[model samples]
Target: MGLNAPLVSPRPSDGYDHRFTEVDYLRGMERLVHAVQELSLARSLSDIQRIVRTSARELIGCDGTTFVLRDDGICYYADEDAIAPLWKGGRFPMTTCISGWVMLNRAAVVIPDIYADARIPHAAYRPTFVHSLVMVPIRTLEPVGAIGAYWAQERAATSREVSLLQALADSTSIAMENVRIYAELEQRVRDRTADLERANEEIHQMSLTDDLTGLTNRRGFYLLGESALRAARRNNHHCLLAYIDVDGLKRVNDELGHDAGDSLIADVSEVLRTMLRESDILARIGGDEFCVLVTEPGGDTARLKDRLAEAFRTFNTTQARPYRLSASVGLALTHPESSHTLDELLTLADELMYADKKAATESRAGGVNTG
Candidate 1:
């Protein structure tokens, strides 16, 4: 298409005339600004690419156009047409080629006649029948990409046309920068949401864990106990709670160091966890107190107690340590008809635990070893 064909604006004063009226220049500037706004508001990268190609084709009045961008240290042409394949999928070092030259120099280059300009290497324009071309770097101070338009017929580009393309290139730069900033902001928002979710999960875990033994703490125990009670009350089934108190833990802490005391607590917690069912809840409430909430009331309660005793036996026999890990356990059963509240049931279990501890102490004083 002819440059002054009026396709873009009113025909430029007929013929090889390079001069432009002041009104024509202002109208072209206004059109360039409108095109830039349209491109900037594009929703996706694909949409932006389409708009860029169409804009270049219309603004520069070329038969074919090529749009290219640099990403990950590699240059890629965004066009799919096969007529002008400068380096289709072939790598061009950013130091060479008209597009690369414009990118590196960060300025617009206009060639009135491609064959006459010494800078226009002959081999570059040989593939396409293009004789005259104009290249404008689509960027601000730092070049991000370039847009090139080619003509099949040999014709000289006017100063007004070159200036108009430069303005359009500048608009392209702003649109590209705006899109980049928007994408970065979206990515940052996603990253922040993921970080918040991770932090919330960690906080939840900490709230349910005991600081000393790494087991479920008192708050965890009550929460689990309440849920179990509600389930049993709903189904008219039964559940049990076993309150356990470790024997002679305070004496060990006083005689040895706090590290030894911590080791003892951790070992006991591990034993309890290993002996219980995966569905059961094991929590450390006080310095040497723990609670296990079993789902079923009758047979499972007895089985869980046996498992706990076996775990302690195995630990005492395997370890060469002088101090023994032992506990007094008290059981409390809850049924649908039971009148006791959750707290009341726990109080009854605590009283039974004290009775067991008293009986164990009496036996120890009588020089009778339960083990």
Candidate 2:
């Protein structure tokens, strides 16, 4: 008979000793101990497959072994270590395969004669040397896969061999569970980190922004204004600092409600945004005070003042309100190659703004409306 032909040895009824010797038991135990250690360190499914494929065969003294995974209703023979090829990278229907039966039943099976057993598809074994086999589920509760050991002759699988194979499958199941848990933990940490970064960025933006006017606050002005001043000085360019205070804000707040004062401030901020170029740095530094830093050389202060007066005139003519919108403006110009600091320029602008406010108040002493 050919080597692949059915080689059915008589069963234990013929008094043949089918069990391995005590020395073989010791060797199997030694290999199993080492396999458990390796499995404990496995990080992925492929790692488990690699460690189990060879270790299972050595531990059970099988002619061939296969690591099978249950892919939905399909049984996939993913890896194998054998004397000859035994269905590596092959797929079969879960209902028609022995490994699938083991996984679906969540138990182990030991087949002594491939041709006699109804569970074994006899036609599938005709091309191979497999005559007997032992299949065990990876997990007894909810089986994920199965480990199979095949022999070239008919021999009843001893209880010890089945136990050893089942132990290996249990370890593999634990390793796979660990891999899943580790992946979930890693994803959760990444998600939390992204959330924290977004929150921190929002907090930073809130710290530098004025809540009422939606403009830069005093801290932001100093931070960005210093950078602009340094750049202007390095280029030897003339820069201007303009300080403006809204007129009659306190009077409006005292007469009308604070809501009207807030609306007036918002309107003033909108007017300043419309008058200034996009590159100009504008900030609300106090309750009724605003500042602008123009870094470019040759800014026209007279034209800017004229545009502000015209805009206020148009607004007062169009809007019906208890008080008109007006502001006292003062400017401090730093010449090219000047050594004036940003704080010094702001102080100078504040002094000039107070002087302009005094002049306007005196001019209104002739019974003329100032706002």
> Could you estimate the TM-score for every candidate?
0.73, 0.67
- Which number leads on lDDT? 2
Model 1 segments more than 4 A misplaced: 1-27, 38-51, 79-91, 110-132, 140-142, 151-156, 178-204, 228-238, 296-298, 335-341, 361-371
45-102: candidate 2 lDDT, tens digit per residue: 8899999999998997889999999898899999999898889999999889899899
RMSD of each: 5.7, 7.3
Judging by TM-score against the true structure, name the best candidate.
Answer: 1
All candidates' lDDT scores? 0.72, 0.84
In model 1, residue pairs whose N, Cα or C atoms come closer than 3 Å (at least 3 residues apart or on different chains), thus clashing, are: none
Estimate, for each residue in 1-371, the C-alpha lDDT of model 1 and write its tens digit. Answer: 22244434454443433334546555666677777788879656666777767666665456666777765445567652324555445555666567777877787776757787776667856876777677777774777777777667665555666777776777777777777788899889999999999999989989999998888899988888788788877878777888888877788889987788888888889888887888788899999899987766563556656667777888888887657788888878877777667788789889888877776754442111232
In angstroms, give how far residue 219 of model 1 lies from its true place. 1.5
TM-score of 1: 0.73
